[model samples]
Target: MSDFTQQPQNQHGSHQPYPGPYGGAPAPQPQPVRNGLGTAALVLGVIGALAGVIPLLFWVAGVLGVLALILGLSGRGRAKRGEAANKGVATAGAVLGLVAMILSVVGAVIVFKAASDVVEEVDKALDSASTAPKDPSTAESGAPAAEETPDGKPLAAGDASVYDDDLQVSVSAPKPVEAGEYAIGHTEGNKVYEVSIVVENGGKKAFASDSLAVSARAGAEGATAEEIFDGDTYGKGFTGTVLPGKKATVKYAFDAPADAKTLTVEVTPGFDYNPTQWELTL
Candidate 1:
């Protein structure tokens, strides 16, 4: 035998290296755990994109797309250096995220445009309805002749003063005061007067009566007098909806100064109807 003993060899036919200080070959370094953020970003991006189709959820898609892009870049770097195992998946996630974001924006714009168009159409329909005229037969169904008199007559009491040729408007003389019953009662230094005005929808279309109003004054150039007080529920002076071929009668009352000798009444048709005036000597 030779002076030294033979040592065992590895498969490469070289002698085995000596063991580490305290153990067999040093434990292999553990690999860094694969970052799952890339996968998470991919999932979120898909979900966000779907929700983003709804106009209100577009913001969510943008956030997910950005996150996916960041994770994909990081994962690609790791993969190039042999640190991560899933480079292809990360890239796919990033690309999908970008596509979803673009789709979200486009979808939101389309939905908004459609809604706006619908609203515009509805507005047009309403405008036409409001401006259209009613049929002639309906509007002039019970037309009265125009009456012009210095002293007005009672309308409901069948003594009307003026009736328009087309019967679109009728004005009656001041009704006699029935102080204890229908008239404004117990004025110390004032006289109460009531009048009736009738408006017929002479046009084919229905119209709102928002523009009708009545007023009384001491004389042609006198100060406007106060309207007689009526409870909210009892007062319907010159305010209501009148349909095509329909008729509306408005009752108006005012208190004049006791010594006033002349009173003037003004009936203004709302919505561009010509105003009518009458002078009555008290």
Candidate 2:
């Protein structure tokens, strides 16, 4: 038999096995070094594109992209002289970061414009309904308005005043809503909670003026309530506008921390006013 196929005896003892496939050592891998500025550019770029994210991140991304591009171009020359570096990664980081930066600026401008439009719409509504009567604040007599429902409150009988009642806001689902389809949505890693509406007026004069002030229930109160936006309600394209004699539709879509089966929308008149709540499906 030829020696190539035969097992050989080791020095002074047992048989030795032949080496398997290409000698046994693992193949070498490309080492990954930290691409400093490149990494920063990439991170900033990702953050900048996020809607509802802090606007400053976009600026940071643009700045970092510039830095990465400069360093990468210069470093490419150094690498040929024996410096270990990642030219491709740095280039990509710079490009993506710039894109994020540009988009963020555009997004901000759009938001500003939308806000202006909202103000105008409110003014128009108020002017058109200027003849409608205004109601007293909840502080005036601690009473519910005629448009309000008990929802579960005891009312003292006397002269019936609609201003003494709590408003009825119900949130019903057309079925279960999947996430991300609504404005007030429920998704992981999102920043808002419990979107709702407030009817400044009801009946034909409920929206006494088109100049309405509508804002989300933000910060502390919302946090303490742990209320979240309903996927179903959000999907319906819920939006609120003060239309005298017409129903005011307030819509909210945001991301929340967990899954919920019940969500509520609270309506409050502008300024220090007693608010009302309407429930929605989670």
Count of backbone clashes, every candidate in sequence = 15, 30
lDDT of each: 0.62, 0.43
Candidate achieving the largest TM-score: 1
lDDT for position 58 in model 1: 69
Question: Residue by residue across 1-282, what tens digits does model 2's lDDT show?
Answer: 565665688997788877877867799886554456545544544554453244534455445445545654554444454353665655665565556557657656766777899999998666544432223223234323333335443122111223322222222231232354434334454444434333433334343323333223323235322233454544343334545434444554444334443434443443323444444344
Runs in model 1 deviating more than 4 A are 1-142, 146-169, 178-186, 230-234, 238-240, 259-261, 268-282
Which portions of model 2 miss their true places by more than 4 Å? Answer: 1-34, 50-84, 131-282
For model 1, how does the per-residue alpha-carbon lDDT over 65-96 read when each residue is reduced to its tens digit? 77777777777777777777888877777786
